[model samples]
Target: MRGGGSKNSPLETLGENANLEISGDLISSSTTEKIFEVSTNLGNKIRLAHSSTSNGKVLKEHGYIYNVDAITGLKSITVAFEGELKLTTWYDDILNGQSVNLINNETSKLSGSDCAWFRIEALKETKIDSIKIEYTCDAKDGSFAYTSFDDLGNLDREGAKNKNVTVSLGERNFEQFEYAYDGVEANKYNQKAFVLGNTKLNKYNASVPNVGEYKFTFLNGIIKGGADVKNPDNTNNSHVFMLLPNHSDVVFENVIFDSTVSFHNEFYTNTWAYLNSLTFKNCTFNGGIFDFPAKELTITDCTFNKYINDNGQNDSNPIWVRSGAGQKGEVSLNKVTFTNNTVNAYRPVKFERLGINNNHFELTFLDNTFNMSTFNDTDLKNYGIYLDSGVTYHSFTLIDDGNVINGGNGDKVYAFNGVVDGNFPTKMGTKILDRNGNEKVIVGGKWKSIEEAKLCSSIDEVATDTNINVSSSGTAIDAIKSSFTGDNATKQSTTISLPSGNFSLKDETDRPSLKDKTVVFIGSGVNSTTYLANKSATGTEKGSDYSFDGAKLVVFKDMKISLGTANYNGFVRPQNLVFDNCLIEGMGHYWGDKTTFNNCKFSLSGADYNIYLYSGVDFTFKNCEFNSPTNRFMNAYREETSTEPIKVNITNCKFIGAEDTASAPNAKPVVNIKKYINPIWQITIKNSSLEGALNKEKGFYQAEEGSKGFVSIDGNVVWEAE
Candidate 1:
């Protein structure tokens, strides 16, 4: 009764008087297509599984119904009816065929009807074109609760389920609804066959066409897994879900799918799985796993929550969300939110793609909020956004962003890329919370790009009084090519406007050599920067590498620099430098030998770093501030492989914060001088005040384990020491 009637005479079910006829009022026909009606008590469920090409149109009176919101006057529904509905294709019976006017004759609103309902009339042959489940819902309340279909064929229906409805139509009327049955084949209903929870589902071809105003929710418990053991050999590309739609802009929001239900494989796939030219808005994530094993995907206007469910220990960032394979794609998040649940949730998002390749992926966070419990936590000192360890992104953008660190931690964000765009606040007050209660912590300074960071100034701005201004007596060429580094340039008397931030002589394009140039910095508000120097265009100016003497550049008052790096490698020496009311980054290598800093604050919050230093001349610091989770001043190798000696001088400095047990240093500072075979000679620390936050074994000086060094603190108040 399901398929064709008897193989011998396939037309035996058709009587001699069984000719199909379609009138304006009714449909009359004699055929052997079985019919049935199905209904379910559940609110969100499936109904029929059949092999009838001419399924009937569900009548309004007989359809499984849902209650409506009284105020809205519309049904508050989340019903997915997956039964066969006959289309108005060709009419056939004992005779050849008959034409039918399937169009609704009651009203002349044909265009609106075609646009609203799921109706298709014209067809050549009868085939099951689609096994569709039409889901109707109102997001106003908890009207629809469906979960766990991303894990193919495995549906955990312990949550909310929908009711089902099915009906069969006469062959004559079936021809009227032929458009709804194009190229469809009757097969067993794979109720939840295309879901894979938090795991990956590769090579799925589910067609979604013209899906405007329809929201598809993929939510369920995902299975927890780790990196794949045989990633390279695994043939199936693991994915969380695969959305293959044609000419559809569907809304996918409020969906939760994790690895609790599926098998977790570390090297298996990417987080958020894969996408193809789709727009997702207002989605929330509750996991710390990341993956990038698919071709392409795009996400916009979403919230990612990564707080742990337990205590103070840092949770593992088990999620890997990125794009892999030769599938170029972009994922944009407008106003994306990422919040940690516990103190130890360090890195939330990590991109693994690196260098130049055809398979490119872009992740953007615009006007977003990233909240953390504290910024002072010693164990959780990492950026909210991070790239792959060795990966250098082509371009990354973090614009108009705000972050809150109620506890002790490090930077709010970090990146290694060609271009990074963000508002790098320079002043103490400028980086404060606004009227709306948004905090913009000026951790150090932000530059638009590596080129901008190199130039340090704008196109027309000249380094005068330690501030950027138009070169009144200099030359001006094209508007775009009017930087200070340009040679043989025409001077312009006209002044040009520039964006405001910290400006120093090091940011100038061409200011002679550090040994000869005595660049003066006297700006009111000069923040921190990595390093500023024009690229060695001809290889003769400053050689084809980083070469600067920090001793020669005399920095004046109103300046602050924290931890920063200027060179790609550790081959060049830090130029001669001096600081007055400036905070130099103390975390990195203090490459300058003849360097002097005065009346400046050097804390780990601003100018802290982990770089090594090689001093060869007088290294003096007086009337300065030194407070960091790590040591405020030091000198060492890039790694512990080099045994070079670090020589320096300290005088009349105020050490407020120290490297205590609570705030431990990321790397062991080379405070132990005995470890260095070369040994530091003529070291002096005189007339400096030390108090509030000092390690027991690390005061005036703590040599590396077994290094030879000397420490002296004279004429200063000492609070505590090891």
Candidate 2:
């Protein structure tokens, strides 16, 4: 039943490092739950299914660790599980009339409606102690099969009375148990048990569909000759033992995967899928490369050592997100934690988004140790946790809890090889949170809390044509043209990040519309005396708002763009435009959907409107101030082409009218809304102020007669007029 045959089992290939021996009358359990377990007259514990619920009722009869069969003369035992499937002398335990003789060396397999598979190797005569197992297996450096057995089938240990004891020798210190067996004590067997308790047919693969909840746990063993090869497909494949997405959970505790052979460790040779939840606790993964993509993956108190091979890797390879065409949906890895783990890989933790719909990818390190391994002949991609590029869908943020990562030759704990969007005070490294979740940063390995991240004119991320570090004095628009130098068909330089600089278009320039591009313009924060602005315009000739051919996300933060007579709308979008803590002067922004202006200021004197909304579904302005000296603060004439509704919310904002008293009386309302064909505008203005507007008494809003809209002010606005 456990893979059904002997030839399919792995042949013994144990390491010939030394001989082995154990040092006790019995090897006790090290885990707290199983440590106090003492074998009674009852036989082995018939576990229904190994789970977190360890101490409970068994078979509706006993709660003790063992249960007896109550048979005599070549004594037998009943393995009563929670399913009530008892293992006896009949086919109830064996299928094809294969009788189970509980002697030495031979094992019997049992399964039923409750259990999937279980193997009983050697039975005990009342006084034996090793342990039961869950889906997890324990690996041992030496073999457990002793060469000699007594007349009663007992081992050669002292106080050993009963028969059916299969002896094994090995040593290690996991929790409290100490195993330092003498190598010259006895003969040893050669076996390379990659997984314990599980048959070769049941080594969990992610690509396979789940049969049930897969929770494989490994505890306290030396895992040797381990290979974690992650080929695309066709080497070796398994369609069983899978993880149920959002349901499966596995843990490896106090284990070591030691691959001393230098390169036979190719475990999975297929398009590996993903892990729902997995953990490696107090484990050591030495000398091999493992590719693990997980939704919630945690590596705590583990050590990764000697990850070098004979041929060796060119550079450090990070997490694989498919360097080829991938499946649709959000390409993501979330809530990955490394706590108190020591890693000495070529380049520690690199995560690439793989030029797809990358939503959110983050690495949270708390009190871990990371150092570059200088002892590798292979070239290094020393940029740790480097994501080559970001998508136009969501911002890429770095939440550094805390770590001791060496910044060798300007090594970064995490980095982006290309464009990243957000209010980045720390260039490509944006929104790095501290232990308390405040904004933080890293300066030469050590991290420090900052009041805010400041933007500057530097290519802080990986030097790619997709990033533009604009210069005012030496160079200007070349950085802009260089950002679009890649192949336009694949949109290679699609999501470009514009660093802080005073970029001036000395002549009339019409920047080409970006199809499938989302540009994030960075600048110093609103409180900073330093600033990022479009260089003083040469003439008074303004252009239309920047229109994207096909865009997903656009953000401009801590920056200013004085579009005072520039024939180029360089930024803004049709979807997901979020601006924070920024200022705009003498310009109008055109937006369509999901647009938010938080903690910002906008002023466009002698212009038609500060905002010319093309279309909208959800628009918000929180803690903003708009000084529109010419007319309305905004005029929203939605496109009748889209069926999406218009939802505009303004909270804690101030819309000041014309500066001169004479012009204030002639100023238009705060917002001028035109009629739409189908969708109505549900506008809500709360805790806002309208000063010196022409129509402040009417809540400072004027909609056309046929306009389908409801402007709800809630009487919270402080309306004033000259």
Candidate 3:
């Protein structure tokens, strides 16, 4: 029999020979502020029935043979149990004074026994000084099927600061373990820490969705996949851990992701999510893709071992950072490395630019090593790092410092537009081992080195003789300047030739001045002679308005003119300029009159206008090739008051895009005539074989509205659009 007790008296008393089976609600009076106890002398166990009171009160079950229900009120309850305590419902806001500690310690480990599932969901804006919880379940022979600690709904609401919650899980080995914290408000600044130890599991997954700060530390356990051991498959598609978007100031250390993991935005409307100041230290990723967009991302002392999966799909991108829909970000890889990494499917690291504006996207790779000896694929186009062509239109920067590539058949690093400053591998024919640990050799190539092969591909064999070999006395530009202004300065037309070598113009004072000079530069061949500008000098000069200007007739034949890292405005705009059988690479704006190109090739390297004509008249191209990967070939605009109309004539010419697509959908118009008030522009293409689809009519020229321009397409075979 049970009776009421005071603050000092006993609530229930059982005799030595009595057998009791209690089943009902144990209630306390509203005004009673007392301590309840049970006095037993028969060594019999007392059971607390699972019931709820009318008033807001907490009912906690301890010891053995007890089943607890939901608890409510401001007062906290400490339930310390020796045997298993079955928790069926949720308990929230059960504060005992200012702190609470709930401990569940089993006497011995049991096999096939289920551990308690705690859904610790805090109330809205609830405040507690500190809360400590510990759960331990040691299985002797077998493990629990599933164990989860999910923080459902919104926890840590606004103005709920310094909750100071700590959770510890020990010796609880389960087949599946999940810890999820979702919907944390932005203003809530809570310090939460989780310590997990010895919980060897078949599958474990965790997701932290809080905007505030949090920390997690894992120690001394192999948290792997399901029971298959070799092929540990899970129903949740093999994602181990996820740090959701807008999660900042979080640190995860000493965690081993032996299974696959992804940091993707699984359920979010905005494609461009922000994850700032998140760091992973001393982590190991076995096989999977790590694709996320972040700002100031740091990964130190990490190892990635990527391999193919069962479905014959190599979804192993070690590090893949993509630009958000409209946001800007940066990725930093420091002291990270990859080992046993095979490139059977995709590239190792890819920086994608999905956004239009990418001025703020930057990538830095420092002290990293990529071992590509295990790559078995025969695709030579595969690369260790691939910066796509979309970055050509954006302002992106790449810093690759102290990085080493052990072996690879394809390009080590491939970028479209960026300032690359590092000691990269220059020589080709470096032995690359395949998956069978055998060295592969390239056969039937003209050049032994890859650099030489690239140089030989663009060589023109128009002229074989060099008239006057103008070797550089100091600088190439200075020699050209001295040749035109020295005692042998000629008022008549002169031909200055150069031998088969590279001439670099690197200094500020190394700019050649060709004012009021008529010169023709001839070389041995297009590939043999190259004039390379310094990669650091800008195109703009102080005194002169143009890089090269004021020439009656300036001709360049059988040579390559490379504008290395120079802007469009940093070029020589000569009057009556002619190019014959030459390779004009890189980009520059040309403004002149009476210019002619015969059998010349103009190949642009970046996304810049190939030719910009200012007050151009009688410009003609015969059997020339205009090839640009992205930018337009020509942009011709006229002055309003000028009566001299800009005229461009193309005959027997070939206009090709990047990949020689018959209809180059990726290429801009071949000629774009701007609208002017004076309306003075004319374009004519005759007997030309154009390979790009530039306009709606599938023609080669595009004239602006209200511009007095005439586009005459005669006998031109315009290919179909791709």
Candidate 4:
């Protein structure tokens, strides 16, 4: 999608050259003969194969040689390069190629005048016959970087076995030799479609928003590394698609993630910890996934499928819970689809508690389907809904018909009330009807109530049955906040009793105290106007680009935001905050901090760029829609300094940019790349749709002319017109 020309005449934008035009299908390079003979005096004696003794003179330039075997009449070779490499061969090598009978660990010696080589035996047989290798020279810093023909999706040859490749850069290491075979003729042996490294995005003039009604409805675009934009919104703004916070609350609705959503390991310590609220509505998470870790989480009307991995086995359950070191919160799934991928193993969900505070579990698998064959007998030992806390108010609702709870490892399902067992045919398969033929509260699925199984159990007996409380909080807490500085707050974590009714941040004076905050919204449903400023507040610049490294805030929402006033600027400034179904748009001032937006829409205006980004922040967008500006989208840019840049990310989203925008002059069409020295913009865009006109249009020309830097676009659709 980054190159020029049609599929037949793609621009040969090789790593060796910044931009190169190619008319023919193949690009060739002449062989370089060694200046020195077999003498060891040339540089250092380099080992040819895996032999301990150095067999050939090591040339200063890093490369390799291919030789044919003399005995077996086979050609085999291996290469080690100083930088990135590109390898390709004729179509015949892969398609209808002859399969070789090379055994595992077998080696073939080369036979040429002073040419020493050995056939690197593959673990499995392959039909590959020919190969072309293109590599770059390493820099002086001992870091080897390379981009290959494989990245271009031009391998064209299906290998019987995967290639063994290794890359070393200073203390960093990369070892990828084999990839899964897609089974498709064009994609066989190429397990991974592409690899992104430290990419970035920069834009200008983000849209703004309105007031009261909160709205955030623009899907994020992921570029490798980071994305830095200069957004000055007119209203409050938050994130809308991330398992991790990206400077604002996230809203995940109608999106898909084929891979795992992780926090930027280079910048943040706790990845999935900061979340106000997370909601999954009409989305799909195929691989093992994680939402804002250690936060109030929820899922409704979504599909969570743990598809089988390449090994013909499933990864862990679809959801892996490492809830922020045991903070009290809830994880609810309603009208969701939990399908077991035929290609993988079972156990749809797993939870591990490691935090200090005990969690108040509220899990619901409503109207969901858990394919039976996925889970094995032993899976239930550590699978399904779990309450790691020894004592907590938890609920598990299986609302689907034919929902089978495999009775394995003697594990029984219990409702939050602790008496209503969550299984089929309650009361030991007895028909104990209530006032209207509904089942009785206490089924045989949970620990029994004492009192000799009497017909009329006393209140004291019911209380002592499971030693758990059953009373619900009559009223919802309007505001809750925890703000603890240093050690005192950490030591004195806030705790709210179970069944606390709907928590809401009603007005400017009413903010859930984040001071020493450990507030958990465990009630059935809660609503909060997250990141939205009060109507009376006039002088207040929207909390744009605010950083939250130590603050912990968790919230839940039954409905989503409507894309009103919210901040959208700077690198993730919030330490931990999550939003669910909250509309966040570019309306308020700029306050881009570390935050997560799950199941929210972003469709508003009032910022130079829809979202702005700065340094030291990591964010993610999951299943959110992104409708970019029709003209141009740019982030903050300084013409002089470049030390502290900006970054952001978007995944499993739908992006719609403006139509017929002109390309930025003398620069690529990326935001935050203009007016700076040594500027670095890291962003990654994957698995999304980028609808709208490309740079060839007039609108994009004006925008692209103003920026400079790297922009990596993969697995996205790019339209030529609006």
- lDDT tens digits, residues 1-722, model 3? 00011111111222111122221222222223221112222221121221221121222232111211111111222333332233222122112111222244212221112322222112221112212222232222221111112321122322112221112111222244333323335522132112222112101123334545432222112345512111212213333222232333333333455554444332121324344444554455555544443444566555666544444334344555444411343332111222322233343455554223433234445566666533565544234554444443433334444455555543344322222111111111112222343322111111112331211011122221122457644334555565555564553344567777776434446554567666666665676787653345455532223434676666666678665434444334567667665677766454456777665678777536566654447788765777766636776764435566667888667776544345345555777767765556667788666664443233466666666756777843332111
The alpha-carbon lDDT assigned to residue 399 of candidate 2 equals 53
RMSD of each: 22.5, 16.7, 25.9, 27.1
- Write the number of the candidate with greater TM-score, choosing between 2 and 3: 2
The candidate scoring highest on TM-score is 2
Q: Name the regions of candidate 4 deviating beyond 4 angstroms.
A: 1-478, 481-531, 534-573, 588-593, 605-608, 614-616, 628-645, 657-673, 676-679, 692-709, 715-722
Q: Which portions of model 2 miss their true places by more than 4 Å?
A: 1-38, 41-212, 227-247, 260-274, 316-333, 354-358, 373-385, 390-397, 410-412, 419-431, 441-722
Once model 4 is optimally superposed onto the true structure by TM-score, how far is the C-alpha of residue 527 displaced, in angstroms? 9.1
Q: CA lDDT of each candidate?
A: 0.32, 0.42, 0.41, 0.30
Q: Number of backbone collisions per candidate, in order?
A: 127, 11, 7, 183
- What is the model-wide C-alpha lDDT for candidate 4? 0.30
Best by lDDT: 2
What order do candidates take by lDDT, descending? 2, 3, 1, 4
Q: What are the per-residue Cα lDDT tens digits for candidate 1 across 219-324?
A: 1112323222222122122222322222212233323333211112212123232322333333344444333332233444344554442423243332334344
Model 3 Cα shift for residue 661 (angstroms): 43
How do all the candidates rank in terms of TM-score, highest first?
2, 3, 1, 4
TM per candidate: 0.30, 0.39, 0.33, 0.29
